[model samples]
Target: MKEYKRFLLYGLVVGTVIGFYLIFNLKSFVSYENIFIDKTDFMLSSRLIIYNKTCGLQHWKEKKNFGHRDDIPFFSILSTILSSTEKKIIIIEFGANVGQFSERVLSIPHKIPYIVHSIEPVLTLFHLLRNRSRTFKKEKNDKHFHYNLAISDQSGEKPIYSPSQYGEGSTLGKAFLSNFKEIENVTVTTLPEFIKKYHIKTPISFIKIDVEGFEPEVIRGMNLSINAKIFPLFSFETGETWLDDRSVLAKEYTLKSFVEMLNYFQYDSYFIGNPYLLPISGTYWKNSFDGLRRNPNVLAILRHSQPWKNLKKLLNRIPFTSC
Candidate 1:
């Protein structure tokens, strides 16, 4: 009986030592690295915060945050495809708006490291975006970068307005606002200047802009980079009418003008129809006020570029009815 008792005490002592060793040294093998809360994979030992706000993705009377319906599946596939062909997969999204779309892109697992630079002009939204990016925690070369300044044709400040802190219908004009919150004198910089300031010399895989009818200024501002072929594909949101931003510029750009610019740059515009990217004809402007008629998400890809060629083959991979 004494010998048995001695053997049990030894077993207990060994177990205690093993537990202590694991407690002190487990971090070496196990990753306690900070990561944003992705649906499937996340490390939780230590992280400042997780950016879980759905950015109005929550359906009415429904509990699930379905995520940005059209974006996630498409961009995820786009990133996956482009990562195979491009060395540094850099994606820049303007008007990132609280990092909602950015989260959708960054959360998904990628074959290789990719970079997303989110640009938000609204100060409050920018801060929220910065916080969300902080928890994303750089993984090797893959990272999320955010900027607070608006990009335009020149350096200056502009009055930016929004319906709420969540940033819907954020525009430079108060014409569309009903009980809107306005921020006076938000700083603005040209896109090329911004790229130079950040020393971003790499070619961009994709670009996105949602400046609420400010595409004229944005397109002009990005012309130098466009000419330089820094980005192969870009997407932007359009206003209700072909010419809504009359108050925005010394010269407002009509939908026809926007189309002209695309042709000028050898880019073809298409409307995102869930899994499909339907080409927009030059006469699409005459159909309705909404840009590309009812289609708001405009994808412009450099003509015959590898990204454009690759996208043609990837449409079948995107789920048709997810959105």
Candidate 2:
């Protein structure tokens, strides 16, 4: 009996050590905050496991807090757009899932007049976003416009492939079809068309694109020639394995083409986040795309962009890594 008790005590000690080791290693996976929580993901997972017994549906939950931890630093970079512009700023956000980032933008303490055009195509997510934006406290002159449409190269109904577990995975890219199990038809709009339709005259300050692998389509929708005077800062998601040939959009569309398009439109590329924005050389961009150090997001700057000038001075004062 004593020997059995001794074995049990040793097993307990080993289990405790293993648990702590796992927790320490897992901490590296979560960026920014020590805690990771996605209300929608948790709700959907619970629903699937406890009630539905299926994980084929993605539903929306009210965005009560900043859903992503990374947004804290990302928004700080985003605020530079407003600081650079003397005129009232307008922010256009594509793929605004549940308005978490928009909420962060709205919460920033600033007296500058600003408006947010939050676009989310998914019906369920759009509903949650609309609700959240309505209740958010806005500064005097701060306004928000919610659009239930997808920003793409064309304006029409498009089949957005969505995974049951993560609605944010929904995309207009045909290449992403394999990752998603369900098809959702969403109304699509071009940026130029949206501006015209709404008669938005505010000086566009920034645009954030998170349309999964279909980012090239969003870039195509804009009329850069006329908007060059506004010269808004552009930040967007560059998906993992951007060079993967299996991606439906990637088969025909390459990351190089996307970068070249921005270059043709008079925009320079930079790697942003990590509190400092680093200018990405053509070789570095290519190497990054080829999988040296995968960056989830990149920023585009115009030659005359006032923000880039101030951003350099501001970033230099802080200590940060090139993430």
Residue ranges of candidate 1 with Cα displaced over 4 Å: 1-69, 81-86, 137-140, 165-168, 175-181, 224-228, 241-243, 246-257, 282-295, 315-323
The 0-to-1 C-alpha lDDT of every candidate, in the order given, reads: 0.61, 0.63
lDDT (tens digit, per residue) of candidate 2 on 5-93: 99999999999999898687544224323122334765342111011101101110112211223434667655865533456777888
Sequence-dependent TM-score of model 1: 0.67
Q: Give all TM-scores, in the order shown.
A: 0.67, 0.68
Candidate 1, 111-152: lDDT as tens digits = 567678888887778888888777763557787888877877
Q: Model 1's lDDT to the true fold?
A: 0.61
Q: Candidate 2 has what TM-score?
A: 0.68
Clashing pairs in 2: 175-248
